[model samples]
Target: MKVDPDFLDTLRLGGEFNARQCINCGTCTALCPLGMEIMPRKLFRYALLGNKEAVLKSTEPIYSCLLCKMCEANCPGGVHIAENVRALRSYLNAEVLEV
Candidate 1:
């Protein structure tokens, strides 16, 4: 997938999203009761690496985030995983989904 790494920074700079601080600890994915196949960690990496195709293809898991903040609470990096997931969903809404 084509990656535009700067897009991640744009997300943070353009919005209040804060996924850059993620430490890839997988706490979010672990606490996700849905047992999503790809989420939290992968999505964050895709976003950070600017993998637009992968990121867009991951719409389901992105939208699947329950906003429970379980991962955020356990995060040692203090990454707002839930908020970042919401931001990704919002970006998808405005750019890809356009809804």
Candidate 2:
């Protein structure tokens, strides 16, 4: 799929989030209460690489997050997991969903 080089920056416009801080250590995925492996780390990777299609395909998992911040507490990279998810949702709503 083609990449949208500015996708991450566009997503950031929706809200404040430090997704770039992610270390991809899978800590957030493991700590997920919902057992959703696609939750954060994967999504963040897609966002970082400007893989808009990948991010869009993960819409369900994005909204599924409970935003409990449990994963954030254990993140070695100090990524604001919940906040990033929120930003993704906002991006989808405004840019994709046009809501």
Best by TM-score: 2
Which tens-of-lDDT digit does each residue in 1-99 have in candidate 2? 789998878988999757777878998888898998887898889889999999999989998999999999999988888889999999999988899
TM-score of every prediction relative to native: 0.85, 0.94
* lDDT agreement with native, every candidate: 0.78, 0.88
Report residue 79 deviation for candidate 2 (angstroms).
0.5
Residue 71 C-alpha lDDT in model 2? 95
Clashing pairs in 2: none
Residue-level lDDT tens digits of model 1 in 1-99: 687867876666536676667777777678778888576888788787888788888888888778887777888889877778878877888888779
lDDT of 2: 0.88
Candidate 1: regions farther than 4 A off: none
